[model samples]
Target: GAPVTTALDMSQTQALTRAAAVGSAQARAGGDVVPSAPFLIASHGLLGWYWPVSGKLSVLHSGQGIYYGIVPEGDAGGDNAHMPKSLWVVSRPHNVGSNADAKTARRNFLLKVDASPTEDVHVSEGREELAAVPIASVFTHDAYGYANEVLVADTARGDVLRYALDALDGAASGGGRLPEDDEVKDAHVAMHLFTRKDHINTLLAGDSHALALLHSGGPSRAVLFDKECAAQASA
Candidate 1:
């Protein structure tokens, strides 16, 4: 695949979609030499799909009307600055339409996207379904990212969920969501590994590890998880 040298907007997205559609037709007709184009396809409708082309890209969309189609990551230098090294979660706010009811019922959910270091981007197998957790009143702005760790403040649940990137990679193979155990076979439950006070509101990734910030009516504090602590917990 060739590198894209131009900026991509909605217009470009539509054009790419057209091209993919043409290629799909050719493929169905059993034609050889179908033009290969990479896409990070996403759709907000109930029934939408993404092409399984081999490349590094991602698609962000939901049934609530958010669409961020296939796009390359990184800076103009193609350095992948915009890409994620492990999985990252974002609190997504949505109000379907301008209707008063919709506006009044505006809500937020945690959208988790996967990533890897070797590729420009990482996506689930289909890239159609996403790993989402309903977070009614989370600290949307409070998130920490480390090479293989993630911490998110779930104010609604009054606790913080920690994540292990490799575990997520393992889970993605079966589907992007975390497994029923919350802990993958060899990985710990990101949600259960750490415990914090109710309404803990922030997090920051340290230079060598991850730190979670919690706030109560009184003072705010940071909790650092170290190897000894993890080992003790496991034991």
Candidate 2:
């Protein structure tokens, strides 16, 4: 016996027909002047998904690696807590070998984004670059929601590196962009090697502490690190 089609099936058939018609029309239109339904925001390879900030969606390109963290614009408990100020992106070159020089590698970037309530969201061209290949990064902020420090986990080196945001900001004096291959190297405020055998995969930051997730052959483990202890060890 012949199968009977239901209403749902009819609707699905209609949708497919419509989509095919649209596709044909787009092809006939030379792929340039096409229907304006879904707008394209960016064309670069996207690493992270769109992040919501102050009622707008923000996007980061894949050029900044596969990891990123948002910095708040205002105090955590204030009215503007929903707004975002900047994005710290882990910028590692595509297909870079593990043996690449970490000290001279052009990695890590900070991009400033406008999150004002009245204006359209805009990502600034000014970027600050660093010379470390960190797999994961987390931002730590003060009560005012201002990011003071950033902690990065270098999986290849099995180390956690900390850098002061203020110092990086200061390095970019004129146009908020760091010079290319400058003589002054960006210094890490503190660094701690977790384990040589097990590498760190992810890093998370809280008010006064941090967490590192490690990967091993047998079993994975999470380590809680005290900020004070890390600072003392670096000293």
Candidate 3:
């Protein structure tokens, strides 16, 4: 059968088209909620979700049946309005195959670092690390208000950054682990906040930098994850 194609503005349109085919095959069984996908979005066009397995871009939704729209900024085009040239991943905030106990648990923010497979990252490794610095402050903050704490990531990826950013010292030792760090020594200074995500949009919204602690079966001590990111704009 002939494939459906679109004349999208994306220069990588052909590549993305090929990826869609891959995504359809990898779609998990049933509609179970997924926390995150191992694939990272390569769209890099203002916004789109990408499954690492197939490297396909996903349509973005604001949830509540609303899709995030692009607002063109004069010559910069639609991508200008949103954060352009950033890391992204496909995340599922609902449904859990193993942890069915959670319907609305933390959405999984796929990883920015293309490490080993999800299975390998989970059992093969013991600890991981992720570090990010906002090049600027968010003009708008979430209900949690200004995220004001450093976190040690737990999941094997970035989807959990926002959730973990608010806590100074706490760890989720099972699913995966991130090295916990302290709050910024200079609070007065304006910088990007280190955080986590439980959804696709959330992952793309925050600092794009993230790492994972893959365990290939070791003595279970502690893994170290850290990094600093700076957006072009600063608050």
Candidate 4:
């Protein structure tokens, strides 16, 4: 059987043909003028320009859609009154990811510098506590709405444990078993352990609720818990 070929575009006179190889198909579809750099359409529809030489991409317009063509200011006649007169050009694009990575690295460096064996011990103990729980995976969520407070999920036991960022203080204080199970519960922050017959496949957290996916052979059930309700009950 002959390999099938797809015609991308149609011309009124003659059809444009290409070898249909690697990026050749794209080049044919894009026409004669090929864009050398990336042009990203932001969520809010801003036209961006990427300069490969400087590895920078800047927004050229703050409009709500793609910029088709820009006419020169002197060429605008009386009928072009509806067209945009001025465009906002961005000179610099902030590297947000680089800044965030630096902040995280600094915090981790300080934690290691303190040299508290207890911190390592607590993490080990927490993992050991869930050893029999058969956790498929674990993830953390900002359930308590604090920079430091998090809810760590144990998929095996259908448990979501509260983690106070300040737990480092307990490790710094001295040798003692880290808070576990009931002791970790507080009025507004604590673990929400689910009692279900089915195995937990995954966990999802919403703004005010946590969803647990059950691994039943038939239609799986999603258990939802009001974050506040669960916290108050455990507290």
Candidate 5:
């Protein structure tokens, strides 16, 4: 029998194809050729693919999902329509497998990469440190389709933190000074939004009005957080 061959396309709907050699093993032993039958495995499957701009691939420890959103042009520039977008990635270091320790000394990171039109771009990691592990994240937007804030859910702390987009972009650009200035601050402040007893696995933001947090460790449930509820709680 010939060996099985498999191919996977991450972006395609029919993602996987497995081909098995036809005819008996004795035919190949007798110096005979045989064709192969290809079978398609069909299902609703999701796969993620990333192509690094650089030739090297950098691995993230306990890396979660990658989110894309419009970068709001707040105070940084007057042109709101032409503002660039960005990619948000969250990672929790020292939080998975045998290397995980309860007393591990490391900081979780929420990284932002500017998706500029031109080749000029920079990657920014938030300096506002979180000792807890971040499990999921999402970007909330305003009415004009610009990102308002990014919400990160840390299941280790059982809470969510919201970071303003303007502050994040400002810190990444180093304001009006040189980006290499040590005097330039990169710490983006985060506001504590809410907490939960169950572990949050994912975050979803609705059309400028609502957010949904999905909890999945125990009894699965989703909690909706609306703007009215947030305003009321703040009051």
Candidate 6:
């Protein structure tokens, strides 16, 4: 039998379309790969997508965009087609850091990237997506400058994160906090590599919000909540 064809009206085009991707706790954690759109909050933007071959995240916008991708491998880039997703969510670290040498610089970077309730700063669990290539971020900024050829994989998106850092903020405590300028300047970044594996392996690993929970104190304690999209395994 032949299928019937019909045209959509202007109203239909304007209407919000339900996401085609899957979203469930098992799906998010167990899938090990991002096969479809699940949790997405266009309102909270800062985006990028993954590349399986190289295992890195890339941004389409320059300057202000920071905190590249977080999708893990075996999930992203596993398909081998290596196509970018349409969109993604970006998250800034709670703070940023800079130093004369690698030791100090890494410290500053983690301060901003890690979360702590004692700091009064809140963590925003990233649960958004565009399900397409060329993902972009809405609020991330390059306060420290861009990096060069650094690579990382976003386990959540099954993609990689990439950026070029030119410099670092004075203190790691509030490092991920972008300046009021909305753009990066005098960044003075050097070549270094930061990967999701590094993130997961270290004490500062996991989502920015996850770090917040780890550092929360007393009433300011951190807690997890359902993002509502359903893909999170922990959820």
Best by TM-score: 2
Off by over 4 Å in 5: 1-85, 94-105, 114-146, 175-196, 231-235
Model 5 compared with the native: what TM-score? 0.41
Clashing pairs in 2: 75-144
Candidate 4: lDDT over CA atoms? 0.33
Per-model root-mean-square deviation over C-alphas: 16.5, 16.1, 19.8, 22.7, 16.8, 20.6
For candidate 5, give the lDDT. Answer: 0.35
lDDT of 5 by residue, 1-235 (tens): 2112122233321221111233345446766343221111111111112123432211211223222222223231333234333344443333342223324523443444332222123222222211222212222111112256665554544444455555555555532322222221333222234433455555555544534344544655545555434534443
Model 1: per-residue Cα lDDT over 80-195, one tens digit each: 45543323344334323222232234344334443322334443332334464343233333545555654555444444445555554555556554432243344433332323
Ranking by TM-score: 2, 5, 1, 4, 3, 6
| lDDT (C-alpha) at residue 171 in model 5 | 54
The backbone clash count of each candidate, in order, is 3, 1, 29, 0, 0, 56
- C-alpha local distance difference test of each model: 0.42, 0.46, 0.27, 0.33, 0.35, 0.26
Model 2, CA-based lDDT: 0.46
Root mean square deviation (Cα) for candidate 5 = 16.8
Give the alpha carbon lDDT tens digit for every residue of 1-235 in model 6: 1112123344543441323232344466765565442231111233333344344433232222244333221112434233323222234333342212322222111111211011122223332221212211111222111122222223222212232322222222233343333333333222112222222111112222111111112222222222111123212
List, residue by residue over 97-129, the lDDT tens digit for candidate 4. Answer: 222332122111001011111211222111111
Model 2 lDDT tens row, 190-211: 3555544565666667777776
Among the numbered candidates, top lDDT falls to 2
Score candidate 3 by TM-score against the native: 0.20
Model 5: ten consecutive residues of lowest lDDT:
38-47
